[model samples]
Target: MNDSLDHDITAFLDTWTLDPNQTKSCFLDLKAHLDGLDGVRCEFVSRPGITYSLRAAHANQKKRGLFAMVDVIDDDPADRWLSVCFYNELVDDPKDMGDEVPGGLLGEDAKCFDMYESDDALLAYIKERLGAACHSASCE
Candidate 1:
């Protein structure tokens, strides 16, 4: 993992009041994997929700870049949850990740899911999807 990115992630997690062990372990794990890949930059957006997005250029420069994945944290604590949106252009069923999928997602390409447990299978699945998204691309 890149040091700056690692620091940024830790800082973000620190800002949240939610239990890091309970709600953020999966995301932190995912972030660790993403950090090892090249050109897979992370973008943090604070709006209606705090969203950390992973992005990469597609195989064809003319084509749209892939909005690989995003982890969102809502404003309300009780309503707070981590949501991962995997781009469907390169993934079949992002919502049906190896683990259970969370509710509140509706879109062809915006398939969302939430991870509450540490599942190696799920991480491997995500890595596969990421490879597809970066196929022949400069992602890295």
Candidate 2:
């Protein structure tokens, strides 16, 4: 991440009130995983009162700009949650833990996992999907 992006992300996190369940940690952990990827770049988008999204993509991807989006849903800013989305073709939902959104991802079909509370098991599963998506995107 560049200085500007790092600053922006820090600002977003700073203002976000942590929920009692510690759901914010889930986003932090996922962001750290993305930052560790070999050739990944992430852009942070803030749509205040709607969402604060981290859009991540592999360096080699040509068709789409992003492979996954980690969003902090801000409908209820005081009680925020997460909705991580990925292109359907890039990741497999073997455990059926995500929702099938017909056109949720930039007009393409997407598989999204919603998190309202901190859960190590679910976070681990999502991390696996992120890795899978990064690999698939890199191949493109």
Candidate 3:
């Protein structure tokens, strides 16, 4: 939310080391990538931060666990790049949790769990880990 913080953070990102700026750059890159996707903002769920994939949502329609939801936490003293991590959801089954999960979210595969700082990396996760999680009933 803080543009100035973003600026400083990005400055740190270019150094090729783990710093607060790396986190900012990562987030900024994400914002830019998601924005360019379909002209719609990548909805961010803060407090317990994460990213939602509208495209995946549309594709799956009735099914969620198709999109990406990155989880951010304050692991460091300053709370920067390393702390802001991402993870996708697995549907396992449509009826497993019903409406609790959002549309297009992916789940059901253990491999889906991974960390990323870029949209591209996140996308790879969807194709790999989350993509494998089947509808909950299948597990039953």
Model 1 residue 13 CA deviation (Å) reads 1.4
Q: Kindly list the per-residue Cα lDDT of model 3 for residues 29-110, writing each as its tens digit.
A: 5445444443222343333232222222223334433244433333442443322221224333232212233222333322
Which pairs of residues collide in candidate 2? none
The lDDT values for all models are 0.54, 0.95, 0.35
Question: Backbone collision count in every prediction?
Answer: 0, 0, 25
Q: List the candidate 2 regions with Cα displacement exceeding 4 Å.
A: none
TM for every model, in the order presented, reads: 0.61, 0.98, 0.38
lDDT of 3 at 87: 24
- lDDT (10s digit) by residue, model 1, range 14-119: 7766654355666666666665666555654445465554444343434444445556465554345556664444446554663333332233345555654455
Instruction: Superpose all Cα atoms of candidate 2 onto the true structure and report the RMSD in Å to 1 decimal.
Output: 0.7
lDDT of 2 by residue, 22-62 (tens): 88899999999999999999999999999999999999999
Error of model 1, residue 32, in angstroms: 1.5
Give each prediction's root-mean-square deviation over alpha carbons.
Answer: 5.0, 0.7, 10.1
